[model samples]
Each structure stands twice: as C-alpha cells, then as structure tokens.
Target: PDFKPLPKTNQSVGIDLGITDFAILSDGRKVDNQRFTTKMEQKLKREQRKLSRRYEQAKKDNRDVRECKNYQKQRMKVARLHERVAFQREDFLNKRSTELIRHYDPICIENLNAKGMLKNHKLAKAIRDVSWSMFIEKLMYKAKWYGRNIVKIDRFYPSSQLCYVCGHRDGKKSLEIREWTCPACHTPLDRDVNASRNILAEGLRLFETTQP
Candidate 1:
C-alpha cells in the first residue's frame, strides 16, 4: 500500500533556543536538550584519570618509551569515547531537525551569531545546548531537501520580552525572570513560549511582506 502525500502549508514557527530546553516551539512545545556532548563529561574525566595514572607509572619506571600494547590500548579507548560523543551529537541534531522539518513548514528561527552569544559566562551551557548555529545548519539543509522554508529574523527581534498577544515590548526583564504575566493582556507568559510566538509572528510578517 502507498502512503498519503504530506500536506504543504505555511506553518509559522519560532524556535527559541536555550540550554536546558534546547528549542521551544511557538505553541509551547519543547524539545529538551540532547546533552549528548555533555553526557560524556564524567566518562571523559575518568578516562583522563586513567591516562594520567598510566603516564605516572611510566615516568616512575623511567621508561623513555610508553608505546607498549597496554598504553596503546588505553589511548585507543579514549579516542573511541571521543568519537562516540561526536557521533551522538551529530545524530541528535540530524534527527531533531528532520522531525521539525517534517512537521512544520516555513520554520522560523533567530539568526543568532553564536560566537558572540557564547561570551556571556552565565549563559554558556544554555547557549551551547541551544546549539543555534548547528541547529540552523541542519534546519536549512533539511528544509531544502523537504522543499520547505527556513526563515531567519534578526537576533534583536525581542521575541522573548515581547508580548505576543498585545505587541507590548518589555525591554527590561532580566534573564532570571522565566515566567511572568503580560502586563498588557494579563496572559501568563512562558518566557520561551512567548518568545517563540513573537519569533513566529515576526517571521510571518517578514515572509508576507516579501511575497509578490
């Protein structure tokens, strides 16, 4: 039996990127952090310890050469772990991007300059998890393959601080305030969700304005 064709429609979406949350959809849906890269932190530390011990033992024995079979095995083990972590991160990004492309058309996201964004010491991990640059890369290629659109708006669009329901912009909210009711509409605001909605709207407006 043949499968039905996928429907094509402009489904305006906003991807609010973060570390703990990864990406938030305009409709309040969340794609949790993959953390594949982070999952190896502990293991990597332990592996380092083992390598350290091996090196210490070699030094104590005054062996100018430590390329013994055991030493080679230990080095190979560390390399394998590094390889695994890289593969996991790639797999996570590919799967997540593909899912988003399949589900939504005209996916809108911020065009973030991640190198500058990562300079904030407080938001480093959160920024990394969002993986804005990697996500955008995957999103663009996948959208192209799927015949969908990936819309990128300015990073200063204020998606998070703007009230999507009332178009009221709050330029003063600190990053600490995760949830706040919109002063204008009294709507309970989810920082991530609200930002996503704003992103979606802004992207839609941009798309329509550019339409012939």
Candidate 2:
C-alpha cells in the first residue's frame, strides 16, 4: 500500500518526556504516563508463580518438563501476559506518534541517553516501563513517513535549568522542585512545560540555520 505524505501544518511542538508524564508539550498539554508494565506486574507475577508450581510438579512426577501439558499451558499463560503489556505500550506509542505527526509540522524533543539513565537503580524500572526509546523510534519513523520534521536538541542543553522566558541559567535543580519562579524575568514556570518551550525555541533556531 502506498502512503501519501500528510499535508503541512503551521503548528509545531516541543515535547518533554518524563516518567511522571509521558510527554509535556510546549503548548501546555500533558500526556499521562500509562505505565502498562506496572499495571500488569501483579497479574504477571501470579502467572509466573503458577508456571513455577507446574514445573515443580512435573519434576516431582519424573515427567519431562517439555512434554508436561500443565507446565506448557502455564508457561503460555505467562507469556501471553507479557505480550499483553508489550502490545498495550506499543499501541499507546503508535497513536500518540501518529497524532503528533499529523498535527505538528516539526516536533522537537531532547536527546536523552536512555541507556545511561537506566544506570540509576531507583529510576531504572520506571524509565524502562515508560519505554522512552521505543516511543522516540516510533516518532522518528512516523515523522519521515508523514513529511514531518523531528528535531532532537543536545543532551546537555539544560532545557530544564534555563528560563524559557528570559534565557536565565538557573543552575541545577532537583527533580522535586516542579515549579519555580525565574529570577531574571520573574515569570512562574512549570518544569516540564518550561523545558518543552526551550526545546522548541532551540530546535527552531537550529532548523533555521541548517536550512538552505
């Protein structure tokens, strides 16, 4: 099947991806983190436990585990549960990416080192559950297919630490500080939204300079 390029739109957006919220847009819209893995964790654990019990029973009966019908059934149940979670995550990402590509001409986002971020034990699970890398991959491919542009700002760009209104460097801030007033411009800022706006501004600047 042929896929025609989508019509161009004047709208552009910057997205700040986070564990708390899936994405915060420069337009002040937030898409909630669905946390599909977390939601299915308890059910998956239960199925896995059942699978283990089936394996143990097979061992006790001197039955070949591979040929044990009960064990195989339980194993399939556990596998299906895992597949469900994966499918749910993929569906959410696809819908969101398609919507963004259709509506926005150029989508801006930060270049995050997802692998490096996973090194933090405290945040690793949440980060993996969100599947930021998968989401970005979807956005990239969709953008190309739909004639939309996707801009990734530098990882060290300090989108959060800088004030979007006045470009004042606020230095480092803990994640706990979700809102702050910019000293330079005295403007109140929402952390994710502020970062998104800055990303948009920086992305446009870079895009313009690179254009022929």
Candidate 3:
C-alpha cells in the first residue's frame, strides 16, 4: 500500500462525531452510526449464556471442562460473535475514513479527549463501541497514504457553542439540547451540523495562516 496517491482536489470538509450518528459533516451530510454492538447485543448475550451453561453443565457432570465438546463448541461460538463485532467495527471505520480521504482535499475534526469522555459510565460502552479514537487513527494514516490532508481543531475550541453564522460564542448548553436558535445571528442550528461547520472554518483558518 505504499506510495499510492489520489487525485488532487481543493475541497475540504469538517466532521462532528457522535454515538447517534457516526459523523455529521459540514456539507450537511450524515453518516449514520451502525451501532454494531447495540444491534447484536441480544445475539451475543445468547451466545454467552450458551457458553456459560455448557461450562456449568460440564462441572456438574464431573467431566473435564476442557475436554467437554459442548463447552468447547459454545465457547467458540461466543468467541466468534466477539470477533464478528470487532471485524465489523474495523471495516466501517476503514470505509468511512477512505471515503473522506478520497472526496475531501483536507479532512477536519475536533480533538476530542476520548479517555475523559470514557469516564462517564453511562456513555462508556456507547463511546467505546463507536471507537472514535480508532477512526481518527485510521483517518490519519489513510490521509497520508492517499495524499490528503487531515486537520484537528483544538480540544479547547468551543465548536458546539460557537455560532457559525456570526462567530458568536454562546454559553454552554446541555447535551440533551440538540437544536437551538443562535442568539446573536438568530440562526436555527442543529448542534452537530453547526459544530461541523465551525470546525471546518477554524481548520481552514489554521491552514491559511500557516501557508507560505
């Protein structure tokens, strides 16, 4: 995969990431989250239950657990289920990152504190399932591999609170509030999309200032 280059383009885009939708783009596009873990949770639980029951039955029957055919079969079933989830996640991230790299000259995204975000127990599973860190890592290397640029806005930048219309920085709002009217510009904004646009603008500004 070395030395591969893509066609040149001056277009750029910014992305806002979320658990509901994998990404929302500055260009008004939404990449719906696959929610692989959520989708297959029931199936996985069933597989896990099968594995557990097999182990218990083996123990109760005084059989060597390792040599029990049923136990081994169920364990492999559970393991394969886990493997499937992992493979699906990687596949989705790869395709998503590749699409962005191919279509946009420069890709912009917020610098998220992933570890800090994971501290919220309620959000931990969903956040880890979405795997924002892994997605960004793929984007970084893929951008370089495909001759595209990738930019990250400062973690401190208030992308969500800033009004894309008039550069107004509004007071912080709770995550529950998805849509709001920007006070300064009276702009009706979808939180994620607005953030994406602001990220794009900020990223462009950074690139412009640094250019020769």
Best by lDDT: 2
Model 1: per-residue Cα lDDT at residue 74: 79
Model 2 residue pairs with clashes: none
Per-residue alpha-carbon lDDT of candidate 2 for residues 1-212, written as tens digits (9 for 90 to 100):
45788997899999999999999999999999999989999999888988999899989999999999889988988989999899999999999989899999789999999999999999999999999999999999887777788999999999999999999999999999999999989999999999999999999998888789
Candidate 3 vs. true structure, TM-score: 0.95
Two-way lDDT contest, 1 vs 2, winner:
2
Question: Ten residues in a row with the worst lDDT in model 1?
Answer: 1-10
Writing each residue's lDDT as its tens digit, candidate 1 over 102-121 gives: 88878888888899978998
What is the C-alpha local distance difference test score of each model?
0.81, 0.93, 0.91
Residue 73 error for model 3, in Å?
0.2
- lDDT for model 2 comes to 0.93
TM-score head-to-head 1 vs 3, winner? 3
How many clashes in candidate 2?
0
Give the Cα error of residue 169 in candidate 1, in Å: 1.4
